[model samples]
Target: DPVVVLDFQSLYPSMMIAYNYCYSTCLGRVDQLIEQTEFSEFGCIGLEVRKQLLYKYRNDIHISPNGVVFLKDYVRKGILPKMLDEILETRIMVKNAMKMNNKKQNPSKGLNRKLDARQLGLKMIANFTYGYTSANFSGRMPCVDVADSIVAK
Candidate 1:
């Protein structure tokens, strides 16, 4: 099978936007911003994580111009997709469990219940994947499929 070379064009940027409340910063109330954003309870956790990643991988190591690291050839070919799949699977499990628990806890809220962990996980994975696929190419890392193509050669 010809492996699909999925790319996250602006993963870092999108991550940054989400983490920083960029949309709200432009024009949104605090409540609206909090409600509309994901992972609000985590506060600056995402920002901190992004900073650490950039500092370690992008700045210190100087991997790319935009301060986003690309998966190495070996990692991309051998490990990345597996990691993504694992993430996806875990998300599904969490979401399902959460749904069940919520339903049992409040039967009245069943119809209006929000998604649990698994659903969040699935959304996270999907968003990450989509970001990668739709990222702009300018001043960003170029595509490299040597990893995905490893099995073909």
Candidate 2:
């Protein structure tokens, strides 16, 4: 039996956008960001100069289970979220076109197939982005934190 995975919701992309998880937004782990920024997170004042930034903007940050910290979208929108949103939107548009074409008096099967393929490709791109961050074999550095958070979501 073949499996049909319906991902119209785009959960992974949505979650990443909701949490603003991106390499550009990541400010590294708390311990590395400040001498005692980790302490600040625990309610202890840090002696480091940049400690105040984390301490004050605590609510505005998203710390993954792997201890990697990222600024919320309010602080600075991440590029991944924007890119994913566009991909999903384009997929939606393509799907709509396919649907409308199917209802036409004499729909062109070839055009419908092309539109369907385009939408599937867009969905694949949207979903594979998380894999891009977690794949250890990838040429670039993989963000374990982002991958973990995406899984957790």
Candidate 3:
């Protein structure tokens, strides 16, 4: 049997933007909301959203496949999603520069290398966002729900 192999670049990161996944936007697991007392764990606006605004904006949120809820961009644009959009846009610009540099009659190899490195660095940032989000041991503010939702999508 010949199995088809396909890979989507930055799928998780793109999904995070499309689905609006972020610590500040996340509402925690649905079941946990019923079992836990502290809605404050999600942050100030998030806490208020979870406690009160949730009812008013019940139809305006996103519940991931893994049961993690996030506020939609219309309700409250996620910080991570905005950052990712900038990163991805800059990567595209860098890639275009690389192509234009390569097409030059006498392109500088050093400039090409620099542009390639810049694009690669940006891509790597998007590729390993899950690690960035779940890096508790590295002193990062761990966001399990957002990271898990990125993978689930």
> What is the Å distance of residue 148 in model 2 from its true position?
1.2
Residues 76-120 of candidate 3: C-alpha lDDT, one tens digit per residue: 998888988899999999999989988999998999999999999
The sequence of per-residue lDDT tens digits that candidate 2 reaches over residues 27-82 is 66666675553323211222233666778888989887667788899899999998
Summarize candidate 1's per-residue lDDT along 1-153 as a digit string, tens digits. 889887853343233322221211111222333344333222112211233433443322212222222333332222334445555566667666666666685553544245453466465664554344333464132222211122112
Best by lDDT: 3
Provide the lDDT at 143 for model 3: 68
lDDT (C-alpha, whole model) for all candidates: 0.36, 0.78, 0.80
Candidate 1's C-alpha runs over 4 A off are: 1-77, 102-118, 130-140, 144-153
What local lDDT score does residue 24 receive in model 3, on the 0 to 100 scale? 70
| Residue ranges of candidate 3 with Cα displaced over 4 Å | 1-5, 40-51
What's the TM-score of each model vs. the native? Answer: 0.31, 0.77, 0.86
Q: In angstroms, how far off is 56's CA in candidate 2? A: 4.3
RMSD of 1: 16.6
